[model samples]
Target: MPLRLVKRLARDWFLLGMLCAVVLAVLFPEFGASGGPMHADVVADVGIFAVFLLHGLGLPAAQLRAGVVTWRVHVVVQTFTFVVFPLLWWLGDAAVGRWLPSDVSLGLLYLCAVPSTISSSVAMTGAARGNVPAAIFNASLSSLLGIVLTPLIIGLFASATGQSLSMGEAVLKLATLLLLPLALGQLLRPLVGAWFARYRPYTNAFDRAMILLLVYASFCDSIASGAFSKYGAQVLGLAFLGAVLLLAIVLALTTRVARGLGFSKEDEIAVVFCGSKKTLASGVPMARLLFGANPALGLIVLPLMFYHQAQLLVCSLLAERYARRPAPPPGA
Candidate 1:
């Protein structure tokens, strides 16, 4: 590859790390599998707690408050994320679910029901010189809503499929694993917020590291349980294609809808970026909590992993293109 290509690829360190994690899981499943020497389950649980705590601690409350007045942008982004995306997956599943393993189909549905990403959505909106405050507000709100909405959405899917999911139990676990820690972090943020801000880079590193660890552990459990062996490469290939197509559809739809609503150029950029993306940070841990040690956990997260990387590559390019546009005339 050219040096420029190499540099670009290197910038996607999380993507590279994820691939390495899968490779490691495939080669030595025992090391990271649930009861393996690493005690991955305990580690993952603890890490999940810390992850949410840090999120609460770092949440920009003032910015979110500032952005709240832009209810129009929030509604559009949230609708695309929680409504249109899930409806697309449901229709897609109805058309093609028979060809895919049930787990993969469910994974795609889960992907749609999750929230818009936080850091990337804001970063991309800013890179594109869009409405950054609105992006931050909408993205953060999506994640918060996802805490209640994701499981409920999954429960609805479960009902449609005749699978039993205990909503009460799921809610309790979510509170303990996700909600409580987040609240506690927010409560404690006044004391530690400055500390966390000063060490923002380290906190971000921990966040990435936890995600990779969860990926490795989830794949290890799946491999050890013979999940991949049950489904051939063709299933995975189709799922990858589905992820790409889904992203494309959402991107086009969000852009069209933004324009149709007569949003300004900057608002349009925010809508497209914030509305089209999903968060792996929230998805992986949520999957683990939802699915537990089920053998199919790995397959269930496959679509999300694929979608995460796809959004990153596609949005990065799109953001750059938007950034290159000529500045609007003053007081247009």
Candidate 2:
């Protein structure tokens, strides 16, 4: 109802803006340039660095410590978020490999390989009255794990996907862009803690802006690379269906698994948020690393992009619905 809230919604509607950007780019490729539209490939690389810097600010020390102590939640969330998703992606690619272009298959694979998102997971957890600390740890661990694991996963599948690169190269790139900056931020936390407290509002704004820029650059690059030509409406439709289905499946499985492990309803919700969602913020950078500067990245990130927005919208609605309901009548 407030002006600030309205603006926040617009920022989160980044996916819609991205769709519009892509359509415009496809229609008029030279819209942004005096000489010509800026190359999407170049902007993508820059976008990766931008995202990591902002990611550093949100690193959750308390949540991470709590997760390390609990251990079980960590194991369950990680097993599903990292292990299960990647495997399903590979199997899906193998099943549909022949029907889809190799690039589309590869893109889908990359989507599965990306880490869980940090901001949205925590946000949704808070909205659902779930364990915010655990959500933070689940999402943070995914990104850290991704720095090493994603390169390895991609290396194993690269030959099949026809985009082979040594794991070492990708690891080095990820370390430089993501890990090193995060480490520096951690080291500086003590000295800058007061500053962060003082300027928290501004820093938050900057972080949100970086996310928007990354989304814009990623979709813009997709347009410039002629990525849309490779897939028809049919493929896009199927990809959307696949994303929704996979999300639902993962969400249901995570809830069951968490409860089986004896977690409370709130903890189960945290696990669901952390396990079911994928991170487009981290995915784009990882895709660029694995796929090179090729236009195919547009397709590779397409499913994840759509899934990212879908998860947010659906989860937001769900969380709000849950929030509105009264707490179960005092231990009923």
Candidate 3:
């Protein structure tokens, strides 16, 4: 490749790493599958705990408090994440689910149901000179709410499909795996918060590494179980296209609705970024708990992985555009 092309690709190193993970899983499925010698599941569980603990410690209480007064902005962002996004997926699936593999369809719905991303949404909002505090609050609140709401949404869909989903069991596991660690971290924040602040880069790397491990393990299990053989490679293409369309729709709706609600430009930026994005950080770990050792877990998380990268690419450009706009007159 040309030098410029290599530099552009280097910027998406994480996405490239994810692709390498899938290839590894395909080639060496036994090493990372559920009963694999590597014992990936146990390692993933420990990593998940650490990731959320770091999240709790790093989140600044003052930023969350500052954003709390902007109730309307929160409402808009959360409504899109938990309500509108799912409805769109439901309608889209109703129209096309029969044509797609069941697992892929469910993956799209799950993608819609997960929480807004934390680091990227806040980073992009700040990049655009938007309401960073509100972005932080909404992103954080969305993750907390998703622990309950995502399972509930999945349960409802299971019932409608004549499949049994134990909402109680799912919620209990999530509370144990996710919420408990988070609360403990918050309790310990005063003690370790300074350490977390000083070592932010290390914590971020830890988070990314955990996610890549989860992805490898998920695909390993799926491949070992012959899950991907049921569908052709075109299924991957479909998932990517679905992610693009879902993102485009949500972005347009959020931008227009924010304007319609008479939000200032900064608030609109927060609403658009927070509402349109979903977090792989939360989604991958949640999928492991929600689906257990189901062979379809890889297919299930495929859309989320695709959407994660797509949002980063699209929002990076959108943030640049917003950043280029003229600043508003002081105090007016």
Candidate 4:
């Protein structure tokens, strides 16, 4: 294969490269500084707009409706993703406080505050023959709520991490960046839905491209802010371990609790995947917006970066395993 083809292949498969590029750009932002703070904010806004547009393209309305109507599945997934997960994070923080670095601790706290992974939740729910609709509703709802909840959770619990936004400012930004596009998407749903159905593959590709850009920008900001110098590999390693442990605990609890609540295999899988995963794509951007000025925000996002990859891998395996599990004995 030609070298150009190799490069293209690498780009398609390489999440780390996009992340590093953004990190580099942020590290030496002077390469072209026309936008300044206003530009940075605009990029953030546009990126969010693009995100909502992409999500709208594949909003899964039918599945969402089905999930919402199935009150049992909806309740179980939401309770785990929103309520149980946050409580577990708090407990984990207390249990592991002494071992966690201040910045890593803050990152973990922020991770706890984020909503579940939307696309992944849908995909995993499908794989496990779970309530995909419930997964969609719960996951999307989590993201919607996350806009307000993330900032509040961070401000309340992770004060020492030095990342705080006034409730009013956070709400305004979220309304403008996220909710507005969502509303527009809803209004244009017929058109967007048709486009998505006709060119599903391309729509998904475009969405990934937009996320790739945001990922690059946010990571660049981290590098530019001198975050790399402040935090070492040892600290990062600890954060990775903590993130894995946190995810594992959530996964196990959600599955167990869902089963106890009389949820089927499908609902159990949805709960585990949605409740266990955090949005690296969304969280990084939010961190930049909320803690852009705080130097520590860079450190705070490091664990999330690790957690994002780990969750994807672990859940991929678990989703498969659950899919293959034999049906429970009748009336057992």
Model 2 scores what on Cα lDDT? 0.72
> Which residue pairs does candidate 4 place in steric collision?
22-216, 22-219, 22-220, 23-219, 23-220, 26-220, 26-224, 27-224, 130-266
- What would the per-residue lDDT of candidate 3 be over residues 154-246, giving only the tens digit for each residue? 887754333456889899988988999989888998898888889998888888888899999999999999989989797899899999999
User: Which residue ranges in model 3 land beyond 4 Å of their true spot?
Assistant: 1-8, 159-163
Better of 2 and 3 by TM-score: 3
Q: Could you give me the TM-score of model 3 versus the true structure?
A: 0.96
Clashing residue pairs in all predictions, respectively, total 0, 1, 0, 9
lDDT (tens digit, per residue) of candidate 1 on 33-101 = 989999988998998998999889978999999898878999999999999998998888889877777
Error of 1 at 24 (Å): 1.1
lDDT of 2 by residue, 1-332 (tens): 35744555677646555666557655665443112456555555566665676567557586688767556777888888778887887777688666776666666667677888897888988988888878888899998998888877777776677677677778888888788877777776677766776886777666555555444555555566666665667668867777887787787788789888899777887888888888876776677666655555556677787788778766776677656756767767
Task: Give the Cα RMSD of candidate 1.
Answer: 1.8
CA-lDDT, candidates in order: 0.89, 0.72, 0.89, 0.70
Alpha carbon lDDT of residue 3, candidate 4?
Answer: 70
For candidate 1, give the lDDT of residue 220: 95
State every prediction's TM-score relative to the real structure: 0.96, 0.84, 0.96, 0.84
